[model samples]
Target: MTFTLATWNINSVRLREGLVAKLLGEEAPDVLCLQECKSPVEKIPLEQFAALGYRHIVARGQKGYNGVAILSKTPLEDVDGRDFAGLNHARHVAARLENGVVIHNCYVPAGGDIPDREANVKFGQKLDYLSEMRDHFRAQRPHKAILVGDLNIAPREDDVWNHKALLKIVSHTPVEVAALAETQEAGRWVDITRQDIPSGNLYSWWSYRSPDWDAADKGRRLDHIWATPDISGAAHSSRVLRAARGWEQPSDHAPVFATFDL
Candidate 1:
């Protein structure tokens, strides 16, 4: 069966409920994974999404902070969110579909502006978070899994608009990139989006600091969809919905999508 799965860091589900509805109507992805929902699970505005035919959902949320969710048109079985211990943040949620495809959604912490861990507590947390993630997946050894979310690090040179210029930047820093790579290797995750669109300049996030983001085009591939090697061959047709970044009051990040023949 071929189906489309999309990941977007909506920034704030409550703020972009309308855009979410719009995306559901327009893109019609079979499964949608969202990060940075910034709303409690109980206040996720499920009714609006339910109206769009996504009747099933599994999420971990907190008020005005990090949250992750999976909305599916197909039925889902909730997977325990406690897989990664010690890193207790509303950063992950997972579900197994009726077809036995497991979807793991996550929102990795954005290491702050400063690259120095000692100078920035957030940067330290980000590194520790990724370390814990690497250990957890290494132990579990996922198979046939689809991992999606705003991973918050742009690992590839092509993933950032000006790689040289952004090398020292938080997301493009060597340390951050190495940490992200370790996690990917541990999980045996194939970056489906990059696997499909392997050439020049791919990005899912633009900083709000830029006045003319589109014209300046300073963006980063912060969001991602990675599948296990077992299901990697099933992945195809990936794209970043760049226009969503131009939508009124849109989130800094846009949706990235991929299709799979499961």
Candidate 2:
């Protein structure tokens, strides 16, 4: 079977349920994984999404903070909700489709302004979370699985608007990039976005702080989609829905997508 998947950080699922519905009604990806939902699981506005034919959902949510959810047009079974680094945040969730394809959705912490651990607790938490992810993947050795999320790290030099200027910045810093690279190596994951689109100033997130985000075009590829090496070859058509950033009250992050023939 062939299927398409999209991953987005909706910021607040409740506040932007309409946008979610609009995407579902329009793009209609077989599976849509969202991060930063900022709502309780039960409070997620699913009626509209369900009405749009997305009957299957697997989510891990917190009242007004980090949350992740996977809504699917086809049936799916919940498999995991991992608290990497033991922070106990609602940051990760996983589900399995009938075709034996497992999707792991995650929202990595946005390491604070200061990347130094001693100076910033959130920064430390972000590093710890990534360390745990590496360790977990090294042990579990996932196969035929795809992982998607607002990883919150722009690892590649071309991923950011200005790599040299942002080198000291949180998301594009060398330490964070190295950490994410280690985690990817542990999982043997293929970065489907770069794999398909190879060269470009690809970005999935534009900071709301920018007054003219579009004209300035200061953005980062903080969101990502990855598949295990075994099934990586089947994946293609990777892209970022850049226009979503210009949507009404849009999330700072846009959606990333990929298709797989399995």
Candidate 3:
């Protein structure tokens, strides 16, 4: 089977339901995973997506923060979600395709401005969350799984526009990067996007602080698509939909895509 999957942090799905429809109409990936939906599960505007043929959805959501959803054109089973780090935030959801491929949609906390855990509780939470993820994966171990999300950390130097300058920044800090690396290692997950495009200053997120985001082009590759080693070789055609960042009233993030031939 051949399928294309896309992941994006929509910021708020309800506020940008039209944009979601537009994407479903234009790109139409077999499955689309969303993070930071910022809505309750019952409140998500599902009819529109269903109208676009994405009828299958499994999501975990909160009132106005941290949410994740998986919308699929294909049938999905084993609908599951977990609250990592004991934060009780709706930050993750998982479902299984007919092909036995389990897709995990996640939204890691965007640690606050201060990179220091002592100064910022959110920063500590981010580290603790990642540590828990590593422990969980290390204990259970995953196979035939694809994990995608706005991981909130740019692990590679090339992932940020100015790596040295952003080292102290929350998302590009050395500690966050090392923690994320440990989580990936625990799961035996391969960075499919980097595996496909090994060398490039690729980015999926641009700060709204930039007056001219496109021209300044100071962006970070915060979103990611990863697959376990067993199925990693089946993945290809990884790319970021940079143009989506310029869409009308768009989120700071753009969609990341990868096609898998399994």
Q: For every model shown, what is its TM-score relative to the native structure?
A: 0.98, 0.99, 0.99
Off by over 4 Å in 3: none
lDDT of the structure predicted as candidate 2: 0.95
RMSD of each: 1.1, 0.6, 0.7
lDDT of 3 by residue, 1-262 (tens): 9999999999999999998999999999999999999999999999999999999998998889999999999898856787789999998899999999999898999989999889899999999999988998899899999999999999999999999999889999989999999999999999999999999899999999999999999999999999999999999999999999999999999999999999
Q: Model 1, poorest ten-residue lDDT window?
A: 80-89
Give Cα-based local distance difference scores for all models: 0.92, 0.95, 0.95
Runs off by more than 4 Å, candidate 1: 83-87
Sort the predicted structures by TM-score, highest score first: 2, 3, 1
Candidate with top lDDT is: 2
lDDT of 3: 0.95
